[model samples]
Target: MPHTDVQMDTHDIALETPPADVFMAPSICKSDLLAGKSYSHFSPIPAHISDDMTTECVLGVDEAGRGPVLGPMVYALYYLPMELQQSLLADTHHFDDSKVLTPEVRSSLMRKLCTDGSDLHRASGWATRLLSARDISAHMLQPAQYNLNAQAMDATIDLIKEVLAKGVNVKEIYIDTIGRPEVYQKKLERIWPTIRITVAKKADSLYPVVSAASVCAKVTRDAALDVCYEPYQDTAVNEDKATEASTHVAWGSGYPSDARTSTWLKQNIDPVFGWGNECRFSWGTAKELLEGKTADVKVDWPVEDDANGDMRMTDFFAAKTEAGGDELVDWFGKRVTEEMEDF
Candidate 1:
């Protein structure tokens, strides 16, 4: 779509909606979070699109919670008629880089976007993919499997694909990048050759669509943290203990540097388990606890399964075979013949 010039004052039209219903119920998504997975959410489709309108659309992508030691990392895509990007966002909606907006302002902007009759709601479509804390930890802790960068790339690609699958006419795409812009831009270009792509550092501040996407991703992440509760409990506990265990415990911004977050980590860490599903055990603070303070706990990595043989490193040193190659087999046989001992 051709960029349009419109004369309008920022904040000329104010909009309002009911209180935030942005977060899903803990019961609805807690299982997925506990299982260490990502879940997606699509904003309600606008009521109508003008039949005469055939403008190619533009999409922007950004993420939130990338560095958090708790909660989910959310990647969001925001798409709208290309021509209206500047006028609708900069001139009217007053969106900038979401980090610049106060929490109240971010919530307000999202509420307007969700409100049915508002121009933003009518003209825009957005989606978010929330990569849970448990899942992030699982990936990061894996031996040479997926790292945070790999997970982020997958999430970004998945979000864009999801938005396109919903049938939005996405043409030009803008992205805020965590790494080298040239590398990320080239990678995306190879995937969707026909679509124009721009990947840049701080693209959210440079492009309104990216800014809007940032707001969506940030607000959703914040709301998720706002409602986060312990996904697993051995038994039902009293409200006081339950509250002490979960949502009532405030973790400020989930950043390791935040004083509140560090304090929460120090206060709630289980000596053996470390923390609940809310924690990214692979992160330094939690990792240190397991490695430095609680090293006495016998922990196993790369658990034995149908694919991997059940051999611990200690077994090789403790047993001897004729050729040494068969020591594990002999060790197992001897263990079966005698009493087996736990590690």
Candidate 2:
């Protein structure tokens, strides 16, 4: 009887259909498989796969909204089959760190990747809840960094458990380093002993799996922002409240160093709401507000200068009065001297 053999490729396992004569008795290999001819021929697979039968699933984890002044921390997990890794990498060639991609490009890529059917499993979790500026101010809460780090880990672990429940065989977990890579890995190991955790700097940019996780996390957070904006718009219009307007206003970046965001914070200082309804009170912007600092005091707009280079309030009035001193007095039915008397 002729020997039978099986071959596998990166994308799939190719099983050769046996010949008709094999119906009586199939030839089977009784000797141990040679290293070069068996699984050892290919590079070692990710640890997530054990005994060739278990499906190899890579769990990519990433967090979003870490730098935002408002909104909860969002962590997402993406479980993708190891076989599809190469194809996914090719499809998302433009994929890099989510921070590096423009919002428009990120949105376009996200729509394309999410629709593809490749046995992908995903889960996301938000922080306990968005800490309001009022709560922070009243309780004298810790800095934003403390709150953010705490929430990030909380969301991450919760999402991991969710993916596990969905029957995803998560063998290895990759997380983009948040505070310190080594420290985070140690912490994560304590929570999940069975899983191998790799925390690396800019892992999302370096790994396709991590980048896919990032895209999903960002899309989910952005959707939450849309929901947050809806209630804010309703409050601004129906309540006839300008203070509420600042809450919903998309102040550029919403960071303390941002002039527009700082100015908005200063303009709408509410003891109850702190800087603004949406402003994260634990941030430096809220700290400045609590210290009674004003954004307008930071810098002043340039004033126009007259011909003599002296700063003038109205260039039009000065230029026009000099050109038509007599005509201006006649039109107003008043003498130039009479008008200048008050000045």
* Top lDDT prediction, candidate number: 1
Against the reference, the lDDT scores of all candidates come to 0.73, 0.49
The lDDT of model 1 is 0.73
Please, what are the lDDT tens digits per residue for candidate 2 over residues 1-343? 1111112232221011111121110011112111101000111222333333267566677766555454333465555566555455436345566665555555665555443332221221111122232332333354433444665576577767765654557678888865899988998899889988899988898777787667655554454433333333434444554354324334433334445445655666665445333445555545555544542334345977656666576653444554566444466667767878988
Instruction: Please provide, for model 1 over 1-343, each residue's C-alpha lDDT reduced to its tens digit, 9 standing for 90 to 100.
Output: 1111122222211111112343342213555665666788777545433432345788999998777677788888888888889999989988988777766788888888887789998888888888888888787777766887788889889988877776667789999997899998899999999999999999999999999999888887776765464443233457765643223335666776665676778877776788876777778766775677545465757855664267787865677766764565565445553446543
In candidate 1, the residue pairs with backbone N, CA or C atoms under 3 Å apart (3 or more residues apart, or in different chains) clash, namely none
User: Which ranges in model 1 have alpha carbons more than 4 Å from their true place?
Assistant: 1-36, 47-53, 230-249, 293-343
- The all-Cα superposition gives candidate 1 an RMSD in Å to the true structure of 12.1
TM-score, every prediction: 0.73, 0.55
* Model 2 CA deviation exceeding 4 Å by range: 1-54, 89-93, 113-146, 231-249, 275-277, 293-343
In TM-score terms, candidate 1 sits at 0.73
